[model samples]
Target chain A: MVYDVSKLTDFHYSALKEISNIGIGNAATSLATMLGSEVKVMTPDLKVARIEEVAEFSGGADKLVSGVLMKLSGCVKGYMVMLLPPESAKLICNTITKEQDSDIKNPMNESLISEVGHILGSTYMTAFSDFLKIDVFASAPFHTYDMIGAIMDNILIQMSQEVEHAIILDTLFTLKGNDMHGKLLTLFDPISLELILEQVNALFR
Target chain B: MIVIGMADYAVTRSPEKLTTLGLGSCVGIALYDPVTKIGGLIHIMLPTIENARFTDNCAKFADSGIPYLIEQMIGIGAVRRRLVAKIAGGAKMFSFNSDASMNIGERNIQATKVVLSEMKVPIISEDVGKNYGRTVVLDTDTGVYYVKSAIKGENVI
Candidate 1:
């Protein structure tokens, strides 16, 4: 059977669903290894929306420490962003910085920004790769904190999509071991997402 | 004296050390004269010509900040000719998103230079454009200022 580009959106979604299922699982595995304990990462309820939606979603939080954004490409090109609340960010910092710090009261250091970017990023892409059963090369991690609206727009606007729509994979990451919670949001465009949804739907039958 | 924070600023003659600490994307704009030791600093956010001023409460933008710093110094008996602007901070905190909007740290440094140049104020020193944060200090006691990034130790700026 010839693969039809017309159904790219369907294939992309199927591939995405598969990617998320495995990506979240892999993230859990990596988190457990990093924490030196079993940390359960749950599959979050998914939503599909445009880039602008995330802006409003992020605003509801009391304090946000970091925004992690990466593009997933190779078979399908989509964007995923991990929004870390200040407390969740601190928890990530604790994984590497805990033993060194005698007190938790001190403000989280700047180094933690790059560190978390490394960890969550790998976990995110790993799951993505697992579902696709292929390695997806990602650029160096991009990170920002306390972004005003214009800054957010400036960063996300560069994502020039070939399709007319986007998909949002909003996953609530409950980092179990140390009372820390984070969120992994996966976004997809028509190019790759439609493939995943179709495959998953067929697999269910 | 003037004290500046990352993305923030302050100015006064109350004998406090006017300082801006942990500057990564922002530049600490400090101006002072030896005759009066009158000094001030602005913790400017992004080096932007657009929406340069975030705070209506005070002159928060870099364009506004340099003028404000110089004016405050002169008000305390410092001459414009004797006043020199020393800038610190504006370190590129992360290299990952080179494509993202506003290379903020770099922009901060450039904008500071532009504004000071237009005012005919010479930039005596600058410690900028690295993957580090700088702690800038202006001494009201002897009218001297210094900039130090934690990893790079102390540099007179």
Candidate 2:
């Protein structure tokens, strides 16, 4: 069985959400350490949606944001994305640079944002692999500042070619005492979800 | 106003508008018949459907989408001979030095042009191919295409 989205039961859904919760918790810790601020993460929201509707789930299609994308390889396959509003990107850059005004478009700050995204991606993936007892690695980060829909179309295109539905694990992280927030999204290939479900099933039975 | 999502297409008549949002690597094709005041728009994600593992959605590929849009327009009382095209989007949002396959934006643009020409649809204007995202609106009354971007301001083509 290919273990498509339609095949996932309530148990599978809850298991997936639990995995996301643990993964995002670890990611929040990494972000808190990096910024020297307390970070709060929402319980990750899991959705099985068509590729076209994903932009709306992230926020809105026209919303301007900085998106960092990383490809996953090895045992798990899919993509990890860090989506930050321009204000959040600027705030993160300013926090690190100790500057009142930091432009996210600047090359230096762009790289900084990319590295932050990389840290979040890797940390989240680490927690996921550890919990699932699987092996996976994220590639170097690719960063772009654009509309959320534009930023994700590339990945959506790849996914659409293979499956009609995508499993999205969306986690929102907020910086304490700051109005800035960002989202980390984990999209797993259909086959990878099957492998993950197998691990989840093994743990219970 | 009707909004067309990624890998989708829509057609409308005069006094109406069609739009597609946040087009990064995807290309939006707009076709209009001036006399009938009918227009159609399609947001396509890939160049061709020939190699795609899932070929069910014709609106997802440029080679299939333009023709499909034209057919829809014709079904809705549009003259194929009088249809003109205006295109937008297909931007390389991020640069990664990998391979040609990674440059999907460029390939999408090329395929759109080829398909448009193949159908004898004259492309009057186009705003495409840069490291930015675009949102496009097509007005059926005047057959005008409005391209909006975040950093680059707005332009009507």
Candidate 3:
């Protein structure tokens, strides 16, 4: 049977959102620790959207941002992305490098951004896997600064080959009550969603 | 201005414009007939539609999308022989993955060239294949293509 993400029950969505909240909460804690400041996190938003429309859903298609991507493997297969506006990216870079102004385009800072995304993705994944009792691993991160649509179209293209729709979990976080904020987005393939739902269902059983 | 989303295409006449945003690995094809001031644009994600599971969206692939755009332009009073092409936005945004398939940007550009040649459409200009993303606009008034990038500034092809 053709798998459809829209067919997912509300219970499944709530469970999924809860898992995302826990995972992103852990990730936020890590970021807060690194920044030596409090981090504010919003409740994760979950949706099933068309692959072509995901860029706009994340933010604006033409909006310039820094994107860090990681591939998911093991029991689940998909991707995790961290999107930061230019200002946020600069703030993070300046804070980490302890410079008044640091260029995010510099190779050193670019790797720094990639490492930050790795931390968020792995921390979030660890909490998620622990909560669901599933084994999943996130690969090394890839970082780029470009238009949101440009940064995402490659992954969307790959996903479109298999499925027309995706389950997206988005969590927003802010640092030190400043304008420094970013988004953590997770895209899980339908087959992987089934695996995740199976674990969620096992709890009720 | 007519905005074409990913895996979509549009055809229009003079004084109108077509634009697609944030093209990374995807290629945007602009076909224009100078005589009629008729133009068409397509944002294609894949190299070809063959062996693809989802074939419903012909605009998603170079092989089918170019032909489909040509047909649309012809339907909108464009002469096939007078049609010239200007292309942009097939960028390898990141180099983390070394897999041959992950080099899709290069593949998309190649496939677009092949298909345009097969359809007898001469490519007048192109701004493609780099590590930066580009947003492209096709101005039907003068049959000029504008390519814009965040880091690389803007270029007219």
- Please provide, for model 1 over A1-205, each residue's C-alpha lDDT reduced to its tens digit, 9 standing for 90 to 100: 3233344455454555556767777776776677675666665555554443344454431133466666666765665666666666666666666653322224344445544555666677766666545556555556655432222332333332133235566666666554776667666564564465554556554
Q: How well is candidate 1 docked (DockQ)?
A: 0.05
Candidate 2 root-mean-square deviation in Å: 1.3
Instruction: Say which docking band candidate 3 falls in.
Output: high
TM-score to native of every candidate shown: 0.51, 0.97, 0.98
Per-residue lDDT value at A89 in model 2: 95
Point out where model 1 deviates above 4 Å. Answer: A1-29, A38-116, A121-205, B1-3, B51-59, B97-102
List ranges where model 3 is wrong by over 4 Å: none
Q: Pick the candidate with the highest DockQ.
A: 3
Question: TM-score ranking from best to worst?
Answer: 3, 2, 1
As for TM-score, the candidate ahead, 1 or 3, is 3
Report the error of model 3 at residue A66, Å: 1.0
lDDT tens digits, residue span A104-204, model 2: 99999999999999999999999999998999999999999889999998888878877777889999999956588999999976778889899999986
The alpha-carbon deviation from the true structure for residue B36 of candidate 1, after best TM-score superposition, in angstroms, is 1.2
Task: Flag regions of model 2 displaced more than 4 Å.
Answer: none
Clash count of each predicted structure? 25, 0, 0
